[model samples]
Target: MKIIQKHELNSLKRSVDQGTEEQREAVKKIIHDVKQRGDAAVQSYTKQFDRVDLEELRVSEDEMDAAYESIDGEFIEILQEAEQNIRRFHERQRTNSWFEPAADGSILGQKITAIDAAGIYVPGGTAAYPSSVFMNVIPAQVAGVERIVMTTPPGKDGNVPEGVLVAAKLLGVHEVYKVGGAQAIAALAYGTESLQPVDKITGPGNVFVALAKREVFGDVDIDMIAGPSEIAVLADDSAKANEVAADLLSQAEHDARSSSVLVTTSRELAEKVEEQIETQLKDLPRYEIARASIDDYGAIIICEEMDEAIAVINEIAAEHLEIMTKDPFGDMAKVKHAGAIFLGPYSSEPVGDYFAGPNHVLPTSGTARFSSPLSVDDFTKKSSIISYSEQALKSNGGKISQFARLEGLEAHARAIETRKERWK
Candidate 1:
């Protein structure tokens, strides 16, 4: 990993910005073709891109049943444990549609209701993220979403991952489609004959899928236009350098474009962490990917002071931020931006990625500056509820009419005037 001083803000945006125009246009064209040709276009793209031939686009219940038999009982039990934690966390976020009434006979509140359906995209070419299915679906399920549709590309042998199918069965996904890439997004955004459209779609994908979601934002709701995964570790003298190195390597292995940074006032600790990463990389399965990521996007910034490190972290607003200082809480209070903050040495990013109650589908790049981690609220809508009784309208009707007339809306003023006659 490259080591830099505290003065390199200008070169940062190059690392974290969204896709180029050419990439975005490619995604847009795919969406256009899917909109016009529907399922045939999706099938063609699946064959050309994934090199898979499929007779049916949706995964059948028999497939899910087969997956149950193929997967081990132990792994299925772990998925269930993760599901319980996720459900318990999101259940707290469930809210009632409430109305407040006054003695004057006025009513006001918000009606909280879940969306009709939700679409979840699971990447399938290189990796299968069954954990993603649990993370994305459980929150919508807790919010009382009626139809939860899932999409993932099938393998070259025309089979979805056993773990992915097992997760769908565990969550009772309304449907599973054997489609992936930007076309899957387009299919979800604009329904075809076989697959039904959904109110909102949530999950992480590659640059193509991210651009597809960006293109179809107005057509349907997306969780966020995610970028590559990222991790920023703020460690000091108290932190164990080996643990910090392991935590950084975890995110680095995600992709060649992934970023991992270490900021510390302890020069000794920074160098130790760097050395440990080099030693640990040799044993990792995805060491090549992690090495390039660390070389291209990773950094160790040795700051003269803790305040300076905090400033740099806020500027980056990484997807995952870990504080391993003496007083982690005190340091966290000063933090202004981060999709999720992990405190102490054991609270690594992967914990949040898998078994932790929080959703792992977070804002990537520097989007944590404005975006938020996925939550149950993402699947629900709020409508303002208001009512007024005759007596209440009579007491306040004159002011309402006057304000409407002042705004030159005579129709609004007349409506209030006509109601006032009944009270008089």
Candidate 2:
């Protein structure tokens, strides 16, 4: 990891929205083929990208039962517990339709309704994260989404991972499909013969998946174009170097492009954490990926003071931010941007990632400055409700018509004028 002062931080910028032409072209072709060919195109892409020739697109009830039996009893219990926590957190985020009435019997309100269906894409290559399945599905379920369809890449054996299947089944998601990548996205957006279209798509995938979501965004609502996972640790002299290093490596091991940064006021602590990262890297199973991530994207920034460190963090707007200062919560008040904030030494990033009842699907690549974590709100739509009583129209219709005329919308003005004439 490169060690630098605050002035050098400008050189370490990463772009979340930028994608190669090749990626965009490839995703475009896949989307077009799926839109035209439907299920056949989805099957072909599944075979090509996943190296699995799947005859059946959806997971059957018998397969789901077998998946439950395959996993250990203890792991199932943990998933259930996590599910409860996640459900409780998201239930609080549920919205209800509300109205405000005036003395003139005019009603102004908002109607909140869940989308008809939601498509959640779970990445099945390299690793199987049942945690992700829970995180993505539970929020949609809480929002009262009617139908939740899940798509994941199948293995060479043409079987979804037992853990993923188990998670979906446990969460009441029965529409599991053996397809992934851009094809799954296209299928969800355009609707294949077997799979009905969904109102929105969520979950993370490779570059192709990201680009596919970007292409299909207007046709269907999408959560966000997530980039590589990233974590930034802000520590002081009181922070433990080993714990800080471990937390940084946790994100680095995610991908070679993943970023892990440490900003601290104490130079000694920074050097120690650097050494600790090197020592820990030797034992990591994904050492090659982690090493590359650290070498290319990782950094240890030395800030002169805590305020300087906080300034650097706000500028980065990392997806995950951990404060290991003496008063982590006290320091958090100064933090203006971060997808998720982990406080103190015990609140590691993984806690929120897995079982701490918060959505792990966070904004990446500095998008935390504006975007938010995936929540129940992502699965629902809000419509403004307006009703004008005869008395209210008589009082306000001329003003409304005048405003519409100012905009040169004659039809809008006439509509209000017609309502006013009824009152007369």
Candidate 3:
């Protein structure tokens, strides 16, 4: 890992991959075919990309049961426990409809309602994220989304990963499809013969999936166009170097473009962490991916003070920020931007990625500077409520008309005054 001064913090804001023009065209072609031909197009792409022939697009009860059987009982228990924790956390994020009555007997407030349907895409192949299933599904479920569906690619054996199916089954997300890539996104956005169109889509995928989501966004809401995983550790002399290196590698192993950075006040800690990372890379199964990520994107920023370290963290605004200082919470207070903050060594980034209650479907690629983690709010829509009594309208109708006229909206002015004229 390269060590740099605090002045180099701006260099960490990476330019997100928007995919090649060829890939974009390819995705557009896939979406168009899926929209036009529906099930046939989805099947064709499965054969082309996934190299699997699917008799049915949907997962069956028998397959789900078989998936359940494939996984051990202990892991099943673990899934259930994780679900409860996630549910408990997201339940707190649930917002209710409210109305406030005024002196004039007018009711003004907001109404919250979950979208009618939600579709979540889970990546298959080398990365089968059962944890992602838990994180994405549980929040929508907690928000009371009625129809929750999932999609994943099938293997050469014509089966989605057993863990994915098991996770979806635990959440009662039975409307899972065996389609992946841009075709699956098309199937979700535009109803196929088998799958009904959803109001919104969430979860992560490859460049094709991201582009497909971008194409279909106006038609249906999407979670986010997330970039590669990132982690920035704000540590001090009190922080242990080996533990910090492991945490940094956790994000590095996710992708070749993933970034793992350490912003510390201690140069000694930075030096030790660099050594530890090189040693740890030897043991990682995804050594090539991690090594490239660390070499190319990762860094160690040496700040002179705790305040300076905190400022660097805010400027970077990494997806996952770990405060590994003597006073982690105190440091967190000064920190302004981060998708998710993990305090101390125990609260590792993966802890949030997996069993931790907070959603792991967080803002990536410095989006935390302006955005937030995926929450129940993403699944739910809010509506403003205005119930004006006769007296209230009579008092405000003229002002409303004046306001409308100010904007040169005559139809809007008449819409309010006509009601007032009838009151007269």
> What's the TM-score of each model vs. the native?
0.96, 0.98, 0.98
Candidate 2: tens digits of C-alpha lDDT, residues 47-165: 89888887789999999999999899999999999999999999999889999999999999999999999999999889998988999999999998999999999999999899999
What does candidate 1's lDDT look like per residue over 1-424, in tens digits?
7788667744444344468999888888999999899889999998998898776899988889999999989998899999998889888988889999999989989999999999999988678899999989999998989999999988888889999999999988849999999999999999988888998989988888888888889989989877788899998999998999999999989988888999998989988998999999999999899998888888999888889899999988999999999989999999999999999988988999889898888887788889898999999999999898887888888899999999999999999899756755
TM-score, model 2 to reference: 0.98
Ranking, lDDT, top scorer first: 2, 3, 1
Score residue 340 of candidate 3 by CA lDDT.
96
lDDT of each: 0.89, 0.93, 0.92
Please report, as a residue range, the 10-residue window in candidate 1 with the lowest summed lDDT. Answer: 9-18
Question: How many backbone clashes does every candidate have?
Answer: 0, 0, 0
The sequence of per-residue lDDT tens digits that candidate 3 reaches over residues 82-106 is 9888889999998889989999999
